[model samples]
Target: MNASLLRRHRGFSLVELMVSVVIGLLALLFATRLIVSGEKNKDAAVGGSDSMQNGMLALFSLSSDATAAGWGLNDPMVAGCDTSFSDASGYALPAMPRAGASITPLAPVVIQSNGANPDLISFNSGTSQAGAGSIKLFADYTVGNTLTVDSKNPYGFNNGDVMVIAPLTPGSGKCTLFQLSGFGPPPNSTILVNSGGAYRFNAIAGLPNPYKQNLAYIYNLGSPTLMHFHTWTVSNGVLLLRATELAGAEAAGVSVTDNVVSIKAQYGFDARPPGPNPYDPTPGADGMQITAWSGTMIDADSDGVAGSPGDYQRIAAVRIAVVARSKNAEKPNSAGLCTATPVAPTVFASSAPAGVAAVPVQVNVAVAGDTVSWQCYRYRVFETIVQIRNAQWRP
Candidate 1:
């Protein structure tokens, strides 16, 4: 009884042990698969979210600067006179046109640095409009370094602050742009007495009677700012914001946001016939329909002239599109020379020129040494229409 009972009660046969081992291995394999799948999904979701943030930030920055295409220099009291701009503020300001027969004011907003590729846009504005603080002039002076503000106490102004005094009254005076030496009997006082030399605002010809008549404003352009010229573009898969004082020249680009593949822009010219004056966007029409929507300059007068007064001045607004992509390269996606499908934002009724069907822009990207398809990466498109404020104010 003892031998038989002991033999029957032995733990189990080798076959039973083998079967149990196989079941355990299968369960472990299933669990491993579930964990791996979950991790992959999480990575994709996180990557998409990050890409969206980057795309959004880039769009916001570009749109903000575009809205301010033409600000402070809308119409200077003195026409075709020289004005200073600030460069230390990390922006690229526009330069006046070279001496010519007719006074050709610099285009408030200009797109340069590329023909059809990534385009760069630049413009000028007041310090406060450009995100810098501003102060009001308390009283007017014939000529002096001392600038008195209406406030008993000067708020948010510093010693090295660059300031601009624009004429509130039509015949008051010219807009004076100058840098502050931060000099005053009492530092940072209500009256900011710049230690620098006198401003050349009144030196120009055709001076109206009184200098500072009404509420002449004092704006902090920036300490080292001559003029604020803000530029936006895309290079090396990143969107950049560059600033410079000279025209058509920009320093090294600063990466404002990442994963930006390309930037496309179109100009809207006001070329409608003289009538009730309807300002509308026609997606796929030529001539008076869309007027001219291209990277190149428009022939606003249709006089076969380039860079003419009628051309640049007729630009009413700008439409821009920014494309961003995911950072992570998914395993399913193989990389080489990938062609990103066209991406158009809602603002654009069509991508191409007038009469042409709107299509997603085809982006040719080089992703070498990676086995991934361009389609494997997720992309986000941001687009908007920016109305040139200064241009609108024009009669």
Candidate 2:
């Protein structure tokens, strides 16, 4: 062998060494890119998982309350053209009967009470005559009517008294209404007219007003189910729903977490003047009107809307709206969930980008569309039409 050939074989050319280094560096670069890509993918998966969890949590919270929209109502407002929960808010009644709570009407629970059209009321078993009974009052309910108290204990009533009719049988919450004959103790014929107590009603769900006598809970549709009912007496002139000092809802099934800042509604009553048909709009006279709602009920109705030939209903119905704030936010007192201002229902709806219906939407992305992640907050509304099927008394 030649000495030069042996030396050449023993040592690598500079080009070979350089090529080897370049190849090694290229391999390192590719490996680094793969590692980085793997890490990025892992992070993306984790972020997606967290977003799903957050949404699930929000859904659970909304579901719990939404399902119970109108619960605990036994003979709720009857389903009718102008009755039930829908008549007022065009929505479902709350499962529970609490203040600032309402639903749309399904039927009309007509009211009446007068010489020819008597106003009736279901007896309160706990405090009705005979302890508990079901009686019907008739002030020509079919036509029109109203009433005034008996000058003696005229306005406002006591727990148990002998003033008007009683339920003929036992009934549920609606047992408070019925039409029976006869007036208090004296059953007089000479002193005819009875004094009336401005039977004003404040059904957070757009129910009838000032429950007078001769009223009926005509629940003629849906399954015969029982519901929970309660009363918020105006003890001492201040209104407050009897409630537990907790997050629990009132008898009008509704709930709120500490995370919920506030929930409120307004009552709008139709008004009319003194004249006759198609009366004028008075200040706050039309049948105990309630409107300008914002978690509050002001005497907006001018006490004019009658319940007779003029109109068998005082409060035509109410326009209920609510405002809720998120209890928790990234920043202290930050109203990122929703503006802290009272957004009018009409304005809110109209202000929304056009082409959207006022209803619950189920979106299922099609095969072709923008593919991106979203984290948005929404307030759900549930509504239904229920009626006063039967005003008969019950257990």
Candidate 3:
């Protein structure tokens, strides 16, 4: 009887058990919410910081490059009018290029620059073209015929081919191209190839440039709008992009990943009014002319031509816009991808109205050293416009 009765006090009473369970449940509930809240906050912070760092890096470099966009050491060396571009025939040299020809490529362009130059600047030896020169000087040009490519030379070339002109030496001749500004392709490149050579992008759009095309640089290391960088291709049904590695890698370009879902970009242009109300309506036009560039100038949709030339020319600036999301959204069971809730809210700076935001930031590539020296800084939109206009400086 003693042993049996001893077991009676060993078990928990009903009221005591209920109380213990309630206390435990409450603590667990609180702890779970705390952990989830902390994780959400951390994700938010990381996303915001990453966005900022990437934005600044991209903005600074593009700005500086644009600033020094067309700088060339020679009076008429071609620095950025689509260097190394070939016609539909695959030969980059165009038989004839008028002022208003289609500069926009329907597909990836195959072009290269070898810095070949005309031996002399012919002047008064005239045919009577008004723009023709009469004095003798070293001729520098945006265009030229290919000189011979000798295996023994830096410019290993065949005798009757074409090449962009550059100096035989780095900083010497008007006969050669020099970097007045420091962005885009080398002002005078004999040979520039990408890391994979021709292995990075869609096979159909392959080209020989190191980064597909010069200064065809992209954001987020060439994720979205990479079409802006070089070319796009499909190999065995897989989509890929080719990028020149700055250095060190076995085909170092990246493939699509889960964390980054979609990337879209828009170039920012300033639409200023001659006065302030550039948007006011005129008699015939939908609206009156304005100085500030608006969406009308942007080929964000990539229809090729800019809708407005005055506005396009005035595109004194550009900003890049991107959309990124977690790859988890692509999963079927995941809560609908378009959640009303944003794990991380983005912060942006804009000058437009309350509802509109401007993502493009300015860069000033202008500097005393090389025009490319501009890639390290930023500028106001119009300031960039001024620089673009100044690209016509001769001598």
The TM-score between candidate 1 and the true structure equals 0.58
Which one is best on lDDT?
Answer: 1
Q: Which is the winner by TM-score between candidate 1 and candidate 2?
A: 1
Cα lDDT, all candidates: 0.54, 0.26, 0.27
Between candidates 2 and 3, the lDDT winner: 3
Candidate 1: which stretches are off by over 4 Å? 1-8, 75-105, 113-117, 126-226, 244-250, 274-292, 333-360, 365-375
Winning candidate number (TM-score): 1
In candidate 2, what are the lDDT values of residues 1-395, reduced to their tens digit?
A: 89999978889878889999999999999999899778655654554454344334433433332232222122212211122221111212222111233322221222111111111111111122222222233322222223222233322223212222212221112222211121344442111212122211112211222333445322211111112222121111112222211123333323222211111121223333433423232333233332221112223333332222112122333221121212121111344443322232121122112342222122211112313111121222222211111222112
Q: Lowest-lDDT window of 10 residues in candidate 3?
A: 117-126
By TM-score, rank the candidates, best first.
1, 3, 2
Global Cα lDDT for candidate 1:
0.54
How would the candidate models be sorted by lDDT, starting from the highest? 1, 3, 2
Model 1: per-residue Cα lDDT over 1-395, one tens digit each: 69879978887889999999999999999999899889878867877887789888887877787786655444322112233332332343333232233222344566652433566666555453344345566666565556665654456565555555555542233455555554456543344333324322223222222246346666565433344566677777778776544333346767787777667666666665433333322112332334556555655545465544445556767777777777875555243443333332232456444563342344444334435665667677777767776544431
